[model samples]
Target: MLKLEDVVEMCRVPHDKKFRLKDHDPGWAGDEDVPKAKRKKFAETLLAESSAELAEAQDRLYAADTWSVLVILQAMDAAGKDGTIKHVMSGVNPQGCQVFSFKQPSTEELDHNFLWRYTKALPERGRIGIFNRSYYEEVLVVRVHPELAQAERIPDAKIEPSFWTDRFEDLNNLERHLSRNGTKVIKFFLNVSKKEQRKRFLKRLNDPTRHWKFSPSDISERGYWDDYMAAYEEAIAATSTKWAPWHVVPADHKWVARAIVAHTIAEAVEGLHSTYPEIGPEKLAAIEAARKQLEAEDSDPD
Candidate 1:
């Protein structure tokens, strides 16, 4: 039985090479030798335990008020981005967590640099910020359709052979800056198989409650699957750094993916060793005096 910690290492993108999306297995959940039923049971149990730890770690992080965490999630359509966020983050204190889901940019957003909107949503110290789809879209989606890159209004000459490379450099610099400023970043590329995505799309079409999620454009985009995969591979490879490593999560099984994400977040925060701020002698004396005064008055009043 492989431990959850061991599983996490398998999902992390190595910082050395050009990341190839084809190298990762989308269906990877747990120990392959274990029976599927047992793996499922283990995942459920582990997730519940991890959730408790996450809540505790988050409280400590909030009290410490010295470090912030940012989680970036990117994936193909129906790859369970929303579900992963919903379940893995369920235990966090809402006051200490913020979620931003980015879609097509507004005209105002388009006027500024690609990272402008995302920087605006960066979490304050002692909070967790989640970006559902982030600035990476400028590379991934735009690379898949270079025509779209024109929206950024770069001079034609500058949008030469090095355009994508320059964008990647910008992303890397931004993440490095965040790290130096005490904001740690974790990026997840939820690797979902085409087959699974098709199944999910069909499921959404069949269920009335999920009808709103289905779109003709989503199907249209499916035709560019290969291009998107290539874009993701290049984007992840170029931008992944030690301070902001990417985790290529196998998102075929919702429960398994949720467990991985929850465990990753909890472990990252706990690793920071954040704690409630220590009280000074004067503060401690004040607390003692307050306690004694309350003790003296409370019983009689009651």
Candidate 2:
């Protein structure tokens, strides 16, 4: 997978000051009509190689106890995030792997600071953790519905502009602290086009296996179109940094998006320099003695 930095670098247009998700005409990804057979072949190759390498790298990560990896994925509805997680992470060892899918806050979750639930889900050292959607929702969703922000118990004076800015600072600081200690953070924004999302939504309603995934409310959210786009653009611009940046992935093609994700994970995992711990001299001698004793016992079994 391309580094989030690389993808953003390639896909964005620098405006007067900040960047946008690129304002291309028909589609953001371009040429979604590429022959399925060709795409399938390319995707198959990437997935196979990446899966093998990911297994090796994660084995080292599990053995070393050196650091943790945090991957946060966010996108609009029908952005293929669930499918992405399911496919991209197929090779990681379950023992060392964890995936968290965040949703609407429960009563208990609603009672605390927005960061409260997120902090508790961070990965332990020597593990890989994934968040399907994370703390950004506090800024994005709440910004759209000002009422929720008020319910957050933040002081009116302390709220307004400080809301998103404060969260960005908190996130940046938290990431820096984690990086200083050992963790690596990677964030992905599955950048599906509005038209493509509509197609996906229609498919969900039309296809049997996917029918359960759709809701009338999903279409309703589309009504807040430009508001969500502004929120996303601001969130991406504010939160992206050297420590932990959000990668805006081209998601019109599921294969391309999945390829990038798998490749990126393999690349990050490979950087850990993890290896199997060496056996001690005492343990080696014990193993030799045990082997000899077992052989002698077998020899006398007649």
Best by TM-score: 1
Candidate 2 global lDDT: 0.78
Candidate 2 local Cα displacement, residue 129, angstroms: 0.5
Q: CA shift at 208, candidate 2, in angstroms?
A: 3.3
lDDT of 2 by residue, 36-113 (tens): 676567677876788789878888888888889999888888888998988888877999988898878877887887
lDDT, candidate 1, 1-302, per-residue tens: 88776888878887887678888899887777989999999888888888889889999999999999999999999999988888888898999999999878889988987889999999999999999999899888888888777877865535554988999999999999999999989999999999999999999999999999988989999999999998898888888788898999899998888888888988998988998999999999999999999888858655
Model 1 residue runs over 4 Å out of place are 157-160, 298-302
- Screening candidate 1 with a backbone cut-off below 3 angstroms (N, C-alpha, C), the clashing residue pairs are none
Q: Give the winner by lDDT.
A: 1
Clashes of 2: 3
Q: Which residue pairs come into collision in candidate 2?
A: 1-260, 1-263, 1-264
